[model samples]
Target: MAIIKVLKRENPYVQIDKTGIDDPNLSWEATGLLTYLVGRPNNWKINIAHLSSVKKNKETSTRKALLELRKYNYCHLFEIRKGGKYIEKFYLVFEVPTQYDEISSNMDVELKEGEKIFYVKVKKERNSNNLPEVENQLMVENIENKGVLPNVEKPKMVKPKVENQALINKELLNNNRMNKEKNHEYDFEEKDDDLRKIEKLFKEFGIDFSIKHKIKIKELLQKNSVDFLISHFKKQYEILKKKENVKSIAAVMSKHLFQGTCEVDSSFLLKKEQENQLQLQKEEKEMKQLNNALQVFLTLPMEKQEAIESEILKKRKEINPQIKKISTFLFHKMIVSDIEILLAKEKLI
Candidate 1:
């Protein structure tokens, strides 16, 4: 039997189950990632990009680790959808394999006004370093009730009598709170800017939306990102403008604002535009070459031009013994163009 040694400390700590650390199904990278994520506050947002930013972390490894965790039921991925459309996604970390039937069953229900259900599952039931005392206790109780890692006994925590240590923890907690507030404020300013840009776009498009319409758009912004919404609305506006019977631009925009059919992937549009540009460039170059070839034919002596045309005409006669009746102008035009083609192919231009 392996003997486990327990240690106690008054400083901040994150509780992770030995069973999780010793899980044979998980690789070292995945286990380490789970430990780091479990140590963050419940409300902390996590993604592969953020995880890869940690020292000595690689994006490919982090992504694979997340997939591995998901496969083993240690991490749960949920899509935050509104009006039957996907808006965002988040993950929930658990120290032990968690039953996800309850969470999955609630995912399909449409959200009502002023209702918040996802946060309860994500943030309200967990605690980690820097959590408020009330929440921390609630999480402790919840974890105990769930019977996760039942083999590891809870260690008794004894606070040190040092005054400076208490003061330092207090100061660190306050600083964390301040930083969260600042980030919240910054997000508010950024959202305000997005709203202003959308308003300007509406004006440019001659869309006369009422205050009610503006409120509806603002609510949509909360669910979808500014860039996505802008792209969707712009494409919808263009489509509506081309319709012969479109009566109201504002009405059309409002109608399709939340509809999944109106959603256009901006990257797809950019790729299509690039392909069209390349085709146009190719055509222009070909036309330039054709014109240059024509100019070279004009500079050739009359006798030489006649000889080239005769050679082409002979080949045509052999292909079709009798030439089809064509207008004199068209026949001459064909002969000259063929001469140009022949000259260009022969490097005579």
Candidate 2:
């Protein structure tokens, strides 16, 4: 809530008869003059010729009233020289009594003017703490000279260049070419070592280097390193030998072993499988039961169903008014009698 304070300035004189000459042609120049004079300091003066243009007759009447007001100590008249010519000036010097205080005080003041009472309202300036100080001479001088105070220069921001898809693709292609070249170099070095190892093995074993044998060795050398190929072949030979040994061992074990000697019950596995099948059957039966219940509920007469719903709604209203509101909105088109029957069938009444 905003806090406002009332300020009042009392009128020094009261009107007796208060009958004004009424003319639609009457101008607001007099009013403007009064407002301008009232806003100035006591000793401030303004030239009469400077008043905005008005009808001659109205201007004469306004000037006459102003003079009368001046005689009554409401204003002061003076003469000033401007451009070597003497001009008549008006100065309103009357003191206007006003009360000043914090806006938080909720006191209201009424000002009397003739037969009318006017209310004076005052409001605290918003964000007064954030307002610039009027007494900052250096800032004021800078603003007067440059129209704005000097401030620290801000660094200009640089925008990042966006790479197009074509440029990105070109960079990726160059990287892949370099990687392929490096891979080719590694492959040549590895193949040279494997070829030397093959030649040495052939010489040591006194194996015939026929064209078919050379082609087979070259094909194997292309796929793997020399050490890796030797280890893989050894592993394959061991696996074959182990498989034969395992078959012999199994044959002996089966001949000596009997069913009575084993403690594991094979029927337990069959029973577990049967239990799982029964669980699936039970789930299917429960689904069928639910489907039957839903069909039975759906087959009931519309009137009976509506009656049950109404009865359910009435019970729900007793339990929670919010639920009743929601249910009423959902089933607003249903008959009251049918809803009552629905509630009775469901034993919810």
Best by lDDT: 1
Q: Against the true structure, candidate 1 has what lDDT? A: 0.62
Report the lDDT tens digits of candidate 1 across residue range 23-112. 999999889977777666544655566778884856666676776777687867655556655566666555667556633543433445
Best by TM-score: 1
| Candidate 2, residue 91: how far the Cα is off, in Å | 76
lDDT of each residue in 1-349, candidate 2, tens digit only: 1111111112443212111112222234433334444443323434344332433534344454444434333333333344545443323222221222211133222323322212223222243346474533343223333544446699999976676978987999999999999977866665767866765655543444455555565667776678875554344334434453444432332222222122223456779989999999999986665445444545688885555555655653312222223233312322333443454466644
TM-score of 1: 0.28
lDDT of 2: 0.42
Q: What's each prediction's clash count?
A: 0, 14
Instruction: Please give the distance, in angstroms, between residue 219's alpha carbon in candidate 1 and its true position after superposition.
Output: 76
What value does the lDDT take at residue 106 in candidate 1?
34
- Candidate 2 residues lying further than 4 Å off, grouped into runs, are 1-266, 309-349
